[model samples]
Target: AEVPVNWCPELGTVLANEEVIDGKSERGGFPVYRRPMKQWMLKITAYADRLLEDLDMLDWPDNVKEMQRNWIGKSEGAEVDFQVADMPDAAIRVYTTRPDTLFGCTYVVLAPEHPLVASLTTPDQEAAVTAYVEAAASKSDLERTETKSKTGVPTGALAVNPVSGERVPIWVADYVLGGYGTGAIMAVPGHDVRDHEFALKYHLPIVQVIAAAGDDSWDIQQEAFTETADTVVVNSESDLVSLNGMSAPDAKEKITA
Candidate 1:
């Protein structure tokens, strides 16, 4: 299968997860980076559900069972499509656990290696984009996934927010990995920590579309993002839908319907 691995040029070997630390091989302290390679592997994902279920019935230590559960890493979400501006046939697909927050989307991010990036980037940004992608090629997956002062370059293209029909800019960012999900993400900075930090660094707009129940005055400007039980949808609307005044669950169903 084609997948990313921690590859070290100095040792000419692929290191295991533990063998790579801070983007270097432990033995030689040689720099390693994620590279796609055809490797013999097992597709254990097919048994993930069964494996998780069996843990509950096993007479194992509580901590061990929990560890196994974490390893399975199941995430439930919907795939949303954001079409490239003026190019309906070309699109960016993203998987998100928060489909109900569609209205809050302020921008879209594509992994540096996503297939569509090259075609979508404008001529004016070609040089900058190429340089950024090259620099990102040598970073480990862990370093890229952590959004510490998230870094990205403009593609000089935009995508249309599916729900609001708003035109949002597209960027090729290091924090998003091509091997994960759809290699693209509809960034809802108002409710997501990674997205929020990226937005703050890039000076992107952050608009709140959900609020604490009965507190219409809640302000996202104060960094009030809590996945609390008491919450309601707010400021989410379009010609085809209005999630305003609805709960997150209800809004998800209505919008996805």
Candidate 2:
């Protein structure tokens, strides 16, 4: 059956995402990337809610039912749109769970295969961006997930934050998967571990937006403070929006509303 298999161009074979390791073909150690050719999907995803409801009538263990529920993978988050700087008509959309940290976003990251990559890249960076994209095409989503080294190339383009109106640099990072939510993300270094690591490696600015009760003295350059429940917003005020001094939960409610 035709399926959306991980196609390894170098290996000349299609593989399941599980079959690839560290972005290479498991059999030949060649690079692999996702290619959506005509493929068969279970068609069961559409009935996930029905299956979840009917599981209650079955004689299955609670853990098994919970496992089934988890497998369905329903995620909740808000999709925020970022306008490309200098490209009045172009925008990059990203899904973020922490919309409250919008003020801290210092950079935007797109999957190497992101459709806007070509149009967004500046002429001076075209060669580098092209090379990075080609290299990243060889990496599987799992490889990108497993490798925490924070590899990326600057697209030489910028995106304007919708909330803060600040312009942030754009980078093409393999850690972002083309098939994932919007293939784009706002890099909030001070509140996200991965983003923090990436920012540190690249020397990008890390703005602290969430501060705990006693965290006013904490140095975010040393570490990212991600404790959501006990934190309050800080350094998040601007002409357009302001969540400064509000609790994290309250800020999220207001920003999302």
Candidate 3:
């Protein structure tokens, strides 16, 4: 919500997010920089549950109702904490549906517009991260996703995996939307298409943790095989817990339990 709006220094008017296009005002074509502004904000998340429950009362079509449900975004996932490296006191929290794949996570990606971007970027990586953040600020969520290339800049910061205690690099990518999920994600490149693409582009490791039935091809370089309830878990090795050889449903239940 902090993207730069069309503002006229001469007219002394502040426009809305919809009023600006291509870094210019729609009406005047005056140059506008995507800048952040301080303003009163509403706590809309407090009403999310209520809004989602009320959708059933609307006399709309099934598709329309489903669309509204998605808009509310009532996702169920564990909010795991990842401690930022070097910044002992700082951390980033991410919500993930597949907590069972924590071992497969090779890296973590944060939306360029994520609030923690500025604080997480190290001194050596500041200039590149700043420019990337600025470019992201100017792009709309849809425009950002339109680019086919899986582009991202490392934050020069690392995060400690909660389960494995392993260190992984943190990155800023336009693919991760600031408003979706938690504005951050544990990148399991082995089972996610988007994550696989990003990892391949950056030469990051890809570890397969889910074994598909009759599908011996666990090679991530070929394609990412999304696990479902029927797939069995594998390579989930950790002192805390292990889901190897367990069905996807069983693994999720055991891990979350």
Candidate 4:
């Protein structure tokens, strides 16, 4: 929740990351910490899918329409409920656009504002989680969404990966907004950039479950396999569902079933 910023005391202004050339403000060469504040926003995300679907009807140029499509950022995925480990009554519901990679889930993330945050956090993490949630309170919805830096605190509790049967740690982060999707996400570090960043920072696991249709060049240590055009599942199999070697779409549908 505590975002980094280039705060320049000489200029008395918080400069943007790009504006700070070599740790100093570009204009005055003032020393700054890349941090600051800003505005309000409305929840227009509920209509993102509708907006993207109707984009073709617009008379705008292809480039502008493409931009609009990117802005909408609508993802088609499934909602999965990961039951809490050792806690029968608690579960965290997550919406993922890549359910086929369920076997690769290294951890789970919950929004700081999630209702189960306080209850799910173990006694050991109470102080740190409280500080994090309190710090996150200052962030606006827009800020939280746009924040690229990942910050989180472990709940000390784990979630049973529904498909893989792996006990993955649960974390609370501001980036996962309480109102977004299901306020939680199955963190598949091997397939998601943001999740990968967090995993690397925290020394968590990164398991690859997808690869190019015919290529086996993916290296989990380097980066996540985000391309799905002709990708197939790899290193993803369980007694309940064996998605290995299937195309992304087929694998998704099969797993979701």
TM-score of each: 0.91, 0.86, 0.83, 0.77
> What is the TM-score (0 to 1) of candidate 3?
0.83
**Candidate lDDT values, in order:** 0.86, 0.85, 0.80, 0.82
**Model 1 segments beyond 4 Å from truth?**
21-24, 29-33
In candidate 1, position 180 carries an lDDT of 79
- The weakest ten consecutive residues by lDDT in model 2 span 1-10
Instruction: Give lDDT tens digits, candidate 4, residues 119-153.
Output: 98999999999999876655555556677788899
By TM-score, the better pick of 3 and 4 is 3
lDDT preference between candidates 1 and 3, better one: 1
Ranking, TM-score, top scorer first: 1, 2, 3, 4
lDDT of 1: 0.86
Superior by lDDT: candidate 3 or candidate 4: 4
lDDT of 1 by residue, 196-230 (tens): 87888788889998788876665675563656477
Off by over 4 Å in 2: 1-5, 8-13, 21-33, 36-70
Worst 10 residues of 4 by lDDT: 32-41
Q: How many Å off is the CA of 33 in candidate 4?
A: 22
RMSD for each of the candidates:
2.0, 3.1, 3.0, 6.8
lDDT of 2 by residue, 176-239 (tens): 8876668899999998999999999999999999988766887999999888777789988888
List pairs with backbone clashes in candidate 2.
2-39, 3-39
- Local accuracy of candidate 3 as per-residue lDDT tens digits, 1-257: 45333354544566665766665566777755544555566777789998988888889999999998887777666887899988888888898988878888889999987889999899999999999988776665555677788789999999998777789999999878776667899999999998988888899888888877767666767788785856877888688888888887677788778
Give the range where candidate 3 is weakest over 10 consecutive residues by summed lDDT: 1-10
